[model samples]
Target: MNKSEMIDAIAARTDLSKVASAKALDAVIETIVESVAQGEAVTLVGFGSFKASERAAREGKNPKTGAKILIPQTIVPKFAAGATFKARVAGKDE
Candidate 1:
């Protein structure tokens, strides 16, 4: 769901006003983004972990031109779901 829809759901579930729920969601998103940008991992039990992974430079094929291209190495954000989160998504547990 989109941010506004998520805010509404959170507000109703927590008995919080929409404004407060929005603020809380914003803070959570901002905190996660900032932490990941700093090359740090953030983990919430029963949820998941966010971290950065390295991509080594490699050769790639340019599909459009059928040519060789050099793919620059970089750090990319990655997420790994916790056991509980994975189970919930797989319909094994909640």
Candidate 2:
């Protein structure tokens, strides 16, 4: 669901007001983003982990012109779902 919908869910599940839920969600998201951007990994049990991964330079073709180009190496964010999350999504009992 979208952010607004998620905020609503959080507000309903907890006794938090919508504004408080939204701020809490924003803080969580900001923390995760900052950690990942700083080359640090963030892990939450029963959820997932976020980290930076290196991508090697490679040759690629431009789709429109079919021209060969060198793709520069970069560090990109990646997520690995925790076993519990995977299991839940797969409809299997943990």
Candidate 3:
């Protein structure tokens, strides 16, 4: 669901109002982004972990021209779902 829909869900599931829920969600997202950008990992049990990963430089072809190009190395964000989350998504968890 989108942000407003998610905010509605959070508000329904908690005592917080929509404004508070939105702020909380925004805070959480900002914190995760900041942590990963700083080369730190953030883990939420039964959910997932977010971290920064290195990508090596590689050669790639331009799709339109079919010309070879060097893709520069970079740091990218990564996420690995927790086992419980995986199980739930796979319908193996109650």
Top candidate (lDDT): 3
lDDT of each: 0.95, 0.97, 0.98
lDDT of 2 at 89: 94
Ranking by TM-score: 3, 2, 1
Residue 15 C-alpha lDDT in model 1 = 80
Q: Please, what are the lDDT tens digits per residue for candidate 1 over residues 1-94?
A: 9999999999999988999999999999999999999999999999999998898999999999999999999999999999998998899993
The residue pairs found clashing in candidate 2 are none
**Stretches > 4 Å off in candidate 1:** none
Residue-level lDDT of model 2, residues 1-94, one tens digit each, is 9999999999999999999999999999999999999999999999999999999999999999999999999999999999999999999964
Q: What is the TM-score of each predicted model, taking all chains together?
A: 0.93, 0.96, 0.97
Off by over 4 Å in 3: none
By TM-score, the best candidate is 3
Clashing pairs in 1: none
- Candidate 3 on 6-94: residue-level lDDT in tens? 99999999999999999999999999999999989999999999999999999999999999999999999999999999999999997
